[model samples]
Target: MKKQKIEISLEVFETISELPKDIQELMNKAQQARENAYAPYSRFRVGTALQLASGEIVLGSNQENAAYPSGLCAERVAVFSAGANFPNQTITSLAITVRSENHEISEAIAPCGACRQSLAEYEQKQKSPIAIYFMGETGEIIKVASVMDLLPLGFDAKYL
Candidate 1:
């Protein structure tokens, strides 16, 4: 067997202010969306803001249910909404952030595996990269160029 390594590169920002003005605004919108999350059970709120090719920004917040499995993540909410409302538009970027009811996050927040796969599909559909900006607990940011980088070996239509 041959040894192989998979490495990914991401950009780190000391603060939201360090990013471009548009990204900073996107982060602000995500934070606002976080305030509206319906996460009574987990009390862990998350927000996502997507920027589309048409220059429209779409926002989403986590919605939880007592059944647990009925809950939807902020990333998917934003992506699905964009797909449903703006099918012709390509998503160019996304800003995500999370907050805990009881504690603070010390590092950047990442999307769950499911969200990564969902985002990978969108990346494939658009045939381009979708920049991901993850906000850390302390207001720092981590930027990924593509969801495909986050979910290696992701399934696509070609596989079916």
Candidate 2:
């Protein structure tokens, strides 16, 4: 048997100000979108903001429902909107952030598996990488060069 190794690099920032101007703005937009989340159940509000090659920024917040799993994640919401609204445009970057009501969160959190899969589809469609940035309510932020970095072995249409 043979073994293989896979590694991904991430950049950590001490504060929002440490990021580039455009990224900082994207993060800020995520924060604003976060405030609109309807997290009555989990109290785990999440927000996502993505920028297109056309310089348009789309924002989304976690939406909850009475049913167990009818809700959608912020990343998927933003990505779907971008796809529907601008089918021909390529998404360039994405920023995600979360705020919890029960406790203080200080570490960066990545997107869930489902969200990752959905994101991978867009990356595949555009034939380009979408830079991802994520963080908690406070503290450091994390940046990944692409969604594949977060999901190295993600499933795509090619698998079918």
Candidate 3:
């Protein structure tokens, strides 16, 4: 047997203004969506905005539930909405942002494990990479070139 390794690279921007116009727009939409999040339980709001190949942007906010496990993350919610509404369009870029209650976020927020798997599946289906931009409530922005960068060695249909 042999050992293997994986590597990923990301860009960190000093401010949102450093991003491109379209990316900036997506990030703005994500922040707007964050305001509508129903996260009374965690008080940690997350928002996601996905830009499809058709240039349409879809937004989603993290929805929490008393049951806990029933809650869905912002990334999955936006991805599912895009799947339901624009099944034919491929998702190109995604922007995610988070805000903490009673405190300011100081670093980029990465997607949870489940969201990463879900995104990886879409990347496999679209046969293209989905760029990701993540931000905190008050700090810098981090950009990943692909969802695969967040979920290496992800399981796919090839395993089945």
Cα lDDT of model 3 by residue, 72-142, tens digit = 99999999999999999999999999998979998999999999999999989999999999999868999
Question: Of models 2 and 3, which has the larger lDDT?
Answer: 2
Model 3 scores a C-alpha lDDT of: 0.95
lDDT of each: 0.93, 0.96, 0.95
lDDT by residue (30-118, candidate 2, tens digit) is 99999999999999999989999999999999999999599999999999999999999999999999999999899999999999999
Order of the predicted models by lDDT, top scorer first: 2, 3, 1
Candidate 3 residues lying further than 4 Å off, grouped into runs, are none
Between the candidate structures 1 and 2, which one is better when assessed by TM-score? Answer: 2
* TM-score of candidate 3 versus the correct structure, residues matched by position: 0.97
lDDT of 1 by residue, 1-160 (tens): 9998999999999988999999999999998999899999999999999999889999999999999999999999999999999998999999999999989976788999999999999999999999999975576799999998788878889978
Instruction: Record all residue pairs in model 2 with backbone atoms less than 3 Å apart, i.e. clashing.
Output: none
TM-score of 1: 0.97
Q: RMSD of each candidate? A: 0.8, 0.7, 0.9
Error of 2 at 120 (Å): 0.4
